[model samples]
Target: MPPFLDREEIAPRQQNPKGYAQWLFTQVMLRVNVPRSMRDSFVLEGSELRVGEDRFDLRLFKRIFLVSIGKASVPMAEHAIQTLGDALPLTGVVVGLGTWAAPPGILSLRGDHPVPGRNSFVAAHELLQLMQTADEDTLVLYLISGGASAMAEAPLDASISSEDLSAFYRRLLHSGLAIGKTNVLRKHFSAIKGGRLALAAGAATRCTVLISDVPPGRLDIVGSGPSLADTSTVEEVRRILAETPLLAPVPEAMARFLEQMPETPKTLPEGRLPSTSLSLLSSDSLIEEAIQLVSTAGYRVIVDNTCDDWDYSDAAKYLVERAREESVASIPLCILSAGEVTVSIKGQAGLGGRNQQWALRVAQLIDGQSNFVAMSVGSDGIDGNSPAAGAVVDGSTWQRALRAGMNPQNALESFNAYPLFEALGDTVDPGPSGNNIRDLRVIFVNKQP
Candidate 1:
């Protein structure tokens, strides 16, 4: 496990609501750590691999190969190796968005995130070559997590250039459309996504393990459901393109591929392929554990599941209003939310993520309320264009920024909350978490007598 904020360090800060909020954030992050989740959910019994209740008999396969993609791919592959040993061979590729060093025997490759790049295309080609030789006697251990959609790719048509795909990704990312919508559009454009990878594996038995980063636990949206079956139709893609405001600016080749959509889209043919199974290693399960911990801490906890899709500014307003509506008698209230929020950059770009921007907005709203302390963080330990996981702030944040000769409104307007938080020493940087479970937000409301 990586070095985390020690409980002792947090203990000193816990005397006030501001310090306690940081401690609570650390607790929430600990619950969803990737290695712990993988070990808890997977077990090995001789030649049989048990993932939760599902089991795969490795004795039946002549060879086993691991194909991992996403932010958490390297760690996940590590755990799989620890569990199965020689039962599963590690002669496969692992692609992700971090500086993870793949263990010997496993090929470690870097890939782009938020948008596919040249390296991503190269990784896709490599995976395709490996999948082509997989026969019925072989088994592919497919692992995927958040960011897989952009980490690896093979265009449905060879003519779709990387530059064109990057343009499309930028539009979708800025469109503020839901991830599900964006993923659906992405699957149509990629050869490795939307079950194309599964198809390429042919008759080889596949066991897919997922560390889900999608909301509502939709398996299809996680890493664009690379090794799993996709039930989406071309009509769905068309609908998303038509409904979402220019989310997908189709290039000529991509536009032509849409016209070639098969009557029945190519998905993993479950009945036709050798036996395949899926295990959900983790999801937003951290939210439930986080709620339990907060309740045990004596504060009244209010969990809002609807905060995931709201714009950062809107979410900040709703959270503040909800806190205000609560009765004064219930002091030390904690409002918890888990979900990803969209940030549509305007004017000159700033070094901040959605969480920092949201925290900044909340800071602006509760500028006069010293009892309020709010924080938002990406579980993956990376937030937008900034190195900080996110930002935490209270009523004093505005005054602190003013003291630094910075205008809070100007910072927020430019999507530059990272600098303000850094100056205030309020940014949370935990390094790469080896996990991606969306975003976690905690708002502390402690009314004074």
Candidate 2:
């Protein structure tokens, strides 16, 4: 999870907007799950120790292995070590962010993210070597999560550096394009991502178990489908570059890869036969659970939202007005809405991600009505450049800032929400709640406001 979702120290929904969205996000979702029913895909039993069916017996897959990289790799690896313990007979290297420790058999590598760094280059070579030497019996476990884009980068050639890749990736994040478009662009430019990882693991059949943070999940686009076949081509990348001028002058190696796009081959059986076994252990499974729990908590969830035709301003005004309407009826309503949103970033970069920005902007639109509160946050912990996940705003939020002789407008306009919330002492902090589903926001009309 990102830092933005951790702001509220208490239950926020019945009390404020941030709380409701956080509740809907952290309390109801399963960012990771490995049940026995899907055991063939290597059950992630309590986050460690994948129990595979007869399809993958220990004797067949105990050769030298390859553990691919990503954000969730650490915890997933930790759990795997716990499950296998000293009994497992596997020799492999875990290439990922260095902060995580791999048990005695695995070696951990520290890599950078939002962009590849020096360590990423070293890790890339190591992974390339591992993939080359791995035989058909080698069991490759790909640990994929958000931020794998940079953490495990492998440009096709030496012309592109980690700095270049990071700058490119940051531009994509700020582009407001959907994740699909972003990964499509990333796939063409990257050697390790875009199924290149899988192509390397082709010498051996690999099983990829993932916890998807991307909404409306497609196995191919998550972490740019590092271990999956891609139907997208270089010409498509050129088209995106043509349309989104910000991503001009494609790297030469990337252009070459695109021009030389390989033909899609037929699916073959396991045994490193151009095959990859994959599973989605978790996703947006928490929304309905949140609806059930919050609805029964004396708050009426308005379940009929379409989120259509409404700009952020329109949505904010409508929420406050609805709060006013409900207040008159003596009913407190929790307007829960979940989905992805677009941010058209222009000029200088802002300080917050969409969720924090959404909350801050809405704070400006909503009147400090005694009965209203609004907040938003990414289901993941981090938001944009700032450290807060999201925020909660009430009638008192603005006044408290005014009393402190500060300007809320400046904070919202400049995207300095972290400091703004800090001054008010109202940020929700739910450290690493163990799930991601894009972003979640909620407006709660309460009895006490």
Best by TM-score: 1
lDDT of 1 at 269: 47
The TM-scores of all predictions, comma-separated, are 0.93, 0.81
User: Which lDDT value does model 1 have at 419?
Assistant: 88
Model 2 poorest ten-residue lDDT run = 30-39
**C-alpha root-mean-square deviation, candidate 2:** 4.7
Itemize residue pairs with steric clashes in candidate 1: none
**RMSD of model 1 against the true structure:** 2.3
Q: How big is the positional error of residue 76 in model 2, measured in Å on the Cα after superposition?
A: 0.6
Give candidate 2 regions above 4 Å deviation.
1-55, 64-68, 86-88, 95-98, 249-269, 272-283, 302-331, 395-403, 432-435, 447-449
Cα deviation of 444 in candidate 2 (Å)? 2.0
Candidate 2 lDDT, 214-303, residue by residue in tens: 655477777777777776766677778778865655555555555666433224235733344444443344356557767877788764
- Deviation from native of the Cα of residue 76 in model 1, angstroms: 0.5
